[model samples]
Target: YQNDIGQREAERGHLARELHDNALHQLLMLKRSVEEPTAALEFPAAYELLVADLRQIISDLRPATLNYGLRPALDGLVDALSGRDENGPAISLDVSGAGESYGPEVDLHAYRIVQQACENALEHAHPRILTIRGRLEPDLIELTVEDDGQGFDVDAQLDLAKLVAHKHFGLAGLYERAAIIGAELQIDSAPGRGTGVRLTWHSRDK
Candidate 1:
């Protein structure tokens, strides 16, 4: 599943690049065409709007924030994911105790883990607050995504691997992801309380 996810992200990046290049080229051409005062295209404003929307889509598909580093990228992602609901899921992020960089691969996986966790919470939790915290210790790193929302019975959800065998790909995928990185994944939740997703990885992991 990790391989599949990586491949999909590669494909997505490729597609986004192609789309962005073509759209940008066309947008520039249109601007030049309109710049020729003789070319009487009254829809230049519409073209500009379309270009802005297309640029936004491209950014959404392939974020350049990753180039700045993991934590910055995650900060941008949180801003993008948080909704404008006055009373819904006011998201927050915290990063602490940085030692050596975790390397690009670990950062990639870490970002995906947090991204998916926030998405799942937004879709199902209907929460009042969602927080994603990262703690980089001397020998290990831990990520925690917590939400105050409608919680569930963890044991009921597990049912001794039965739930894992079937539906709930979001969570099962998270489990597989943590294992792939030699990380420990934990869930703390109870009905009417809230849910917390935690991923911990020691520096010894490959």
Candidate 2:
């Protein structure tokens, strides 16, 4: 599944680049070369909106920062999701230890897990603070996404039938991603307490 996801992301990236370099560029050129500027003002305005929408789509399909590494990709995720609403949670990321390469596939899966955790928190928990922490060692990589919000029953949510019935795939996806990358995933949450997701991957296991 991870391999399939990676392939899809690659295809999405290619499509995004093509649209940006060819179609979007041509649209821009056409807007600039318009013979009647006043008559085609609406065209320019519409073209700008189109460009912005297309870029956002491209970014959603596959973030470019993932090419650098997991940390930057997570940073981009936090930045994009944070500070959007005044009442939204404050998101922060702290990464320490040796900056080691854990292969692109592993990094991508880890990023997705973190992304899902954050999204779930924001959508359901309504947390005031969301913290993502990463630790990279020579043989082990650990990541934790914690939120100070109204938590849920972890055991009930982890059940497959219950998850499917409720259409809650956030935790399921995190588990799947962690399993795909051979990482140990732990979820801690309670009624009035907060929620925390920790993933630990060992290079030796891989």
In terms of lDDT, the best-performing candidate is 2
TM-score for each model: 0.68, 0.76
Model 1 is weakest, by summed lDDT over 10 consecutive residues, at: 158-167
lDDT of 1 by residue, 1-206 (tens): 54446445554775778667766666666776677766547457647766776766666554667666666777888888765565666899887864345766666676777777887788887788899887766667788999999988888785525534454556666776677677888988999998999989888853
Tens digit per residue, CA lDDT, model 2, 155-179: 7678855554454556666777788
Model 1: runs farther than 4 Å from truth? 1-62, 83-87, 98-100, 159-167
In angstroms, give how far residue 161 of model 1 lies from its true place: 6.2
| Local accuracy by lDDT, each model | 0.72, 0.78
Estimate candidate 1's alpha-carbon lDDT, on a 0 to 1 scale: 0.72
